[model samples]
Target: MIPEEEGVYVFNREARSWVKISEDGPWVPKEDGTYLAYFRNHICPGCKAFDRVWEELIEKCVDKLHAVPALVQCRNFFFDCSDRTASDTFLLFLVNATPQVIVMVVEGGELRYVERCYGFEIESVEDLLAFANEARERMRKYAEEGEAESEEESGEELVVEGGNWKEVVEKLRKLLLEGRNVREVCDERGCRFVVE
Candidate 1:
């Protein structure tokens, strides 16, 4: 479980909304625990549309996964885009898009990114539930195996410039998640993406 001091924003099941748990740096759970995080921007239409189903998922996942729910609002930064304090948190999670669902696990104070799903892919509460179940299974594996390698560790770093968030997300989803070797500028304005 996340320590009270480290819990920055938590989901309130009764209110069915995100609540500020503490004014802290990084804004992610750090102590040993299983966490479900919703990453979004202030002005994203997809994030707005996902609210209802996200609330439903929170209710279901709390009991089913035994995971604490968290929220990261990426307000205005170009790359990381989280509200003032959580920008580093977004970068730490490598979230390049709004409306992303991530599952994180912390063991012995080490944080690991376990699973992720984009909002568009989650059509209903059931989809989110499936995502949660997968994350739960992965977390179990991590605990049993002792420090399994994460996606962030396996992939090379990507540096993107001049692209809109949507385009960057699409390209990254393909390159990273789908394991495609396709390389294309992410925007009409001629963006540059370099994998190093």
Candidate 2:
């Protein structure tokens, strides 16, 4: 349900760990060290291109992403999916609204996670996290498995139309599945979700 007012919500890996992320005063880094951070006040978080299948979904959906490890917590030009940076680190998604999505990743920043306001029949924290984690896991499998499949198919007659590796990457960025993740990705997309 789209609310008339904006809000903030935080989802944690821990059970029942969804809390309303607060921004009372200026945001102070949790640790006093080098960190790659993406911050902004107001920005839309949705994709464009209504006609395209998943293009609209990829429009305004990235909040926090790091291109590299920093010596200090550096500001990321305060953007809301306006610029897509080539990062070898992590991705941060910023959703603009009350009860907006706030992310604080401490480890495995490279292993990304995606979040958004309630997508399905969600009523609790676990429900929300379940959706987010499922999407991420499935997406990862789609990419990794698809790559493996492509390797085998590379010797075939029809090689994805002149070997468009980039097109394959684009499919992943769009969250489409090229092959089944029944093997690699360890069926994380199939089962083992926080919520069903």
Candidate 3:
């Protein structure tokens, strides 16, 4: 499936509504970073460039990353800026912002990494793929670290190893090189699972 290409939409918790605020390629995010409520009303138009870029990304990444299946994604940030609340959706697009990809792991609404460079670069498609793979790696590390912290609070040994995720990373490498559907690959490889 293709990702969103245009303006702000609102995701209302109460009514489960997606109200679209704009229809053009360029859309502005509100002060609170919300577009979901607007999109539900269905008024926003699609962006051609964003559509093209993300379509290419999905085609290139779907077979390598199981992430698509697991996350309800939207390109909240389009013009190098987005509000904090806009990131309620799984993905945020820092379009034309930097020459790199930034992966953030938020658990309980808290940032996990301090220093960037989890392979986030804009040099090439290879760079994006590396960023994606490394992003996942870092997220896994964050989760395990969180688990470790929880365990430490309760007094337990850390049993999970980062080595376990290496297999998925290898598959990701194949998908990046061969241009595979990583969303499907993840399910088949059991890296990450989501019904939709």
Candidate 4:
């Protein structure tokens, strides 16, 4: 049986036992980290049942990998369970189901969506470990490919002619890659950029 602190959407840290994610202090997904996120809602019985499996997986396998354990809740409270609206965190991960496990890797400022499995699909700890292993492999391969692509693009010249959308985008990307602020880069290029 899981401890009271270990129940529901609780994050276990070395310094703390269980830091519950509250509506006022929601846990934000890190922009640059390897994370094994468990998405769930408080009202789902399946989610409650899967809590043990998630905790067990963390205890047994987290040390073997770089992915940090994270609990993401769509509905922070039972009252919000009926609300169909998703939080920004859910939208960022494209999470649409409860009791789902997703491995996320943020490498070189790029977020890579790795493998995922529903809680019901994972019948045992071994099964969950296998999924994690597969995700790690995929992340490695993706990193290798990204390096190769960057090497090839490094020698290419950034030339924008007649304001072609693709070329303009590539220029902006290159500027951002060079560690220039988006607004500053756009201003230097006489281009207007807006986010949100």
Candidate 5:
């Protein structure tokens, strides 16, 4: 059975356990880690074909990564937005097709989107592994960049370019809360300061 979490849940045949996933929700990611999310449904033949590939990939790469598989049920393109489950998560991620895999990263307690691997693009387990490896490398680079930024003085000003000043201010505030050194934000043309 799937656990009561704000994401998707899929049975890991290899592990013989249900793996909880955080595709899109209030659920936080594993501390400073990466999660591989598989979005698919039982009705889609493509999804079924990719399922075997996913299983094999998991069997081979389980020791090297954390993967979550979800079997979503979406009929007539309608989803219950109020519910927080695999179906709802599939909608949240704008998944219109089955067998889509996304990589998510947790940095500073916030969940961030990394990359995605579509089922049609995956021909074998090795393809999946390569995609996952690339995502992991990107996450590593992102973490390193964030760490380097945090080491700098917090008072350093940041020029945020955007058409919506209010939105930019809100984003800058969020970045500041996330331990980013955002001293100020301005419009793209630098006509006025959005936040200072």
Candidate 6:
């Protein structure tokens, strides 16, 4: 008996607020800080079993972290109870099972997926809180690393050699897009490339 039109209601403990979100409405962005999302399905037996545990976990960790509870419904199975936003969110995270918990945070103005736990991961409320804490620490570390990299980049200079500057730049661009480390790229190419 879930209302699809209502979308999803989640209590954000960090903001100490309630957020009603939809794919067509206000969605949580990375700039908003850290949040946990719980994906579930109404007809799922695992979800039913995890419901009680989730409630207890919320009660125990309400003051420690923020969480968003979302119910994902299959269009064919629960047509009337299907929520587009919830379903989309589930797909966005590549969730293939019910009772999935994901910790998300904002780093450099972009959403970062921190950690995820399935139904079997939660034996108690403390376990869930611990997972949240781990995710927070990870986000903090990533933010710090990003800041350090930017600071270093600001002070460095790019020295492109030879005549084909465009080709060199293109190769550098491809390396960056491939997620290779900048320092490693520079060391391997023996070129001092500065990212502006």
Best by TM-score: 1
Q: Per-residue lDDT of 78-156 in model 1, one digit per residue for the tens?
A: 2434343455455455666657878777677666546777787788887776676677577677666654455325656
Quantify all predictions' global Cα lDDT against the true fold: 0.58, 0.27, 0.32, 0.54, 0.53, 0.54
**Candidate 4 structure quality by residue, lDDT tens digits, 1-196:** 2333322244455643545444322233436776677776654567777777777776766665455676666443211333222243444344445577887676655554566777878877777767775676786788799888887775656532421333443444454336543221111112122222
Flag the better candidate by TM-score, 2 or 6: 6
Which lDDT tens digits does candidate 3 get at residues 136-163? 5665687789987886686556442322
| RMSD to native, candidate 2 | 16.7
Supply candidate 1's per-residue lDDT for 60.
52
At residue 123, candidate 4 shows an lDDT of 72
Give lDDT tens digits, candidate 2, residues 1-196.
1111222322232332323333332222343222222222222121111112111212222122221111101112112122233111112232222222222323332323323331112333444334433554555676799888978775646333312333444544344223423111112111110111
Q: How well does model 2 score by local distance difference test?
A: 0.27
Worst 10 residues of 1 by lDDT: 184-193
Q: lDDT tens string, model 6, 46-112?
A: 6667767777766565676454443344422212235655544544454555567778776676666
Q: Residue 117: error of model 1 in Å? A: 1.3
- Models, CA RMSD each: 10.6, 16.7, 17.4, 14.1, 12.8, 14.5
Error of 4 at 146 (Å): 11
**Tens digits of per-residue lDDT for model 5 on 120-166?**
78888778766765676776788799889889848766554423433
Give every collision pair in model 5.
none
Per-model TM-score, in order, reads 0.59, 0.24, 0.30, 0.53, 0.55, 0.57
**Arranged by TM-score, best first:** 1, 6, 5, 4, 3, 2
Candidates 1 and 2: which is better by lDDT? 1
Model 3 spans > 4 angstroms off: 1-53, 66-100, 114-120, 136-196
* Residue 100 in candidate 3, Cα distance off native in Å: 5.6
**How well does candidate 1 score on lDDT at residue 153?**
53
